[model samples]
Target: MVEPGPSISILAGGVTALFAVFLTFYLRNQWQEIQSLRAIQTELEQNNERVRELAQLLTGDLQRQQIDLPIEVPPGTKLEIRYVVSFPSSLSTTAFDQLKHSGMFLRLSPETRRSLFELYDTIDRINRLRQHRERIHFDDIGNVHVVIDPSELDVEPDASVSEDDLSAETRRRLSDLREMRRAMKGVNRSILRLIASIASPEMIDDLELEPFLGTAHGREAGHESNTESPRSDEVDLEEMRSILRDVERESVWSRFM
Candidate 1:
């Protein structure tokens, strides 16, 4: 074969160098995309855990309310009602926001984009509801006194408080609690479904997010396995009453009184 000319050789070298530069940029973009996906996956896992904990607490309270059980206060306790609301950790949207604005995410299938947007929207709704519930508990209902007479101990306080005796504010508060529990259940289901969808083989492959998807799938499986047995809403009313009675005789209660 004849030797190539100098101009042709220089042109070939230029093309090779240009291709290398393009490849470097392409690889860098892919690396950043993977990092963002991983961060989003981690946040999703942490948020799911917080949702589970909140759901459990709400379930217990809802069960007690449904059964018309008293707040487990002893008779003549003269206790002050303190509404201590423990808020869950806020869900991080940093990675999700970044991905949504990125070109890579924009190139994703429209269906996938819609699904992601819906998931984030639902999370936003849950966060807003949580803040509203906290405001109702802390600002609206602050601290109320539960002045229990010694004679009232023989009968359940809930039983003694007639419908006519319940103030409008009390009724509103009860309604708010029930609504919050329902909202929480909805949020829990939505989150679980989102996790399952993102961890599916097709979605994982399309997103090129193997490791993050694997971790998410594992966490989802663990949660489902642990919850295989349905939790009974029923609680031991007598046991709760006894515990409260014991607390009444304790030095802490006496000091507060």
Candidate 2:
């Protein structure tokens, strides 16, 4: 019979080789997981940036809407309401898809996962609303060039055409815009909270999102201060006229076309 010592040595060597192979594969998998996590973190930061930009854009639009409250078509003016749709960043989902497909997204705490889903869902809703709004504005109505001859200007706009008329598609668009703005604010807060929870301290500092998340009351105070000084009807009307004049001078449609 072969010596027991030789047989034991061969078995030990085989075991060692098998262990090495397993270890190598294990380490490689761990490294890949780490890389995936880093990618997810980076993507989250980018999504947050996009969300912030959307928020700022929506805020500006809402402010303009406020300034144009009680929208009116001036007499002898051709009111051209062009649809200028802004798309959200396309980078929002590629990394997220990778993370999900890697099966590592499941490793995140349930709460974090929920927050991420909520944020994405809100973004999807915003996108859908934008698409619908664009369709309604551009396709359904065709060009929104409303020619108000001087005669029509003096005449009160048709009750159906009034800004307050909920039946009016323009009113619906404004309503949807306002809703989207509010949703974007909530999304911003969610993104900030998620970043605060998941981001490394260094990463957080690099992102420079602390100011936006931390200055809630200050922002509110600033908004109040800016809007609290009530303007006269004359001023408001003048502002609306200015906007209309600008719209006329720079046809939004021409730029897009």
Candidate 3:
């Protein structure tokens, strides 16, 4: 009728109680992590749009540039600018860094865990993108001054702009910028979804966690916080170029991968 199982040797005196205590501690830690993730989700939600807007602003700037770099330009006595892409300084991974480094990452559902990794990986990619753009801007600047005559306005440099227009490198940089914007949209979108799922976890492990989390408040279901879709879905060039303008301000500079 019933299946027989292997016999159990009794755990030593404090061993059973120790395990119970540890289980309680682990649940408490998980609750704390839920809070931390919500914080990250909030920060990501706020910044994602800003980052996306910034990237759009950048592509416009690049197109408007008489010299988008990744090309040689006559260093005419003209305007010089250094564009820096910026986001709110509020976002930080310190909490995530700690939890991930600990046993906590193993506590999440496989899907949730994977999503977390994806969110942060994109962040690293964006940082690299920023650095790459900066390198492209600064590295060739010194060389441009060294080789070209100062009389031309780059437009007037030999009395004209390049007949070829944007060089291959410049085109590649614009592509990179759009890709970066898509990535930023992803971070925002994914984090929102994740936090929603966490708020109302369906995994068996999460269900079992309820008694421990009974006192903890959970967020209402947030299936679709953002009504607008990710900008990645669009591939329209005419629309993209409409906003094209000068890159003299700090608002533009483009993407990574």
Report the number of the highest-TM-score candidate: 1
Instruction: Write model 2 residue lDDT over 1-257, tens digit each, in one string.
Output: 79999999999999999999999887666555555655655665665566455545444444444413555544334454433546466435665567666545676657555655654554445444445434544454433333323343334444323454233554666555455444444333433333333333444466554543332445443543221121111111122223323433353332322
TM-score of each: 0.49, 0.46, 0.37
Q: Candidate 2 — what's its lDDT?
A: 0.47
Residues 1-257, model 1: lDDT tens digits: 65579879999999999999999887777666555544555666666566555544443433443313333344334323333446666555676798776655765557555655655654565565556556655555443333334343445544444333444665466555455444444334333333333233443354333332222345434553232211222112222223323433442323422
Total colliding residue pairs, candidate 1: 0
Q: Evaluate residue 186 in candidate 3 and report its C-alpha lDDT on the 0 to 100 scale.
A: 32
Show model 2 residue runs off by greater than 4 Å: 63-86, 101-103, 141-257
Better of 2 and 3 by TM-score: 2
Displacement of residue 142 (Cα, Å) in model 1 is 3.7
How big is the RMSD of model 3? Answer: 19.6
Task: Itemize residue pairs with steric clashes in candidate 1.
Answer: none
Candidate 3 stretches with Cα past 4 Å from truth are: 1-31, 68-92, 102-104, 139-257
Greater lDDT among 1 and 3 belongs to 1
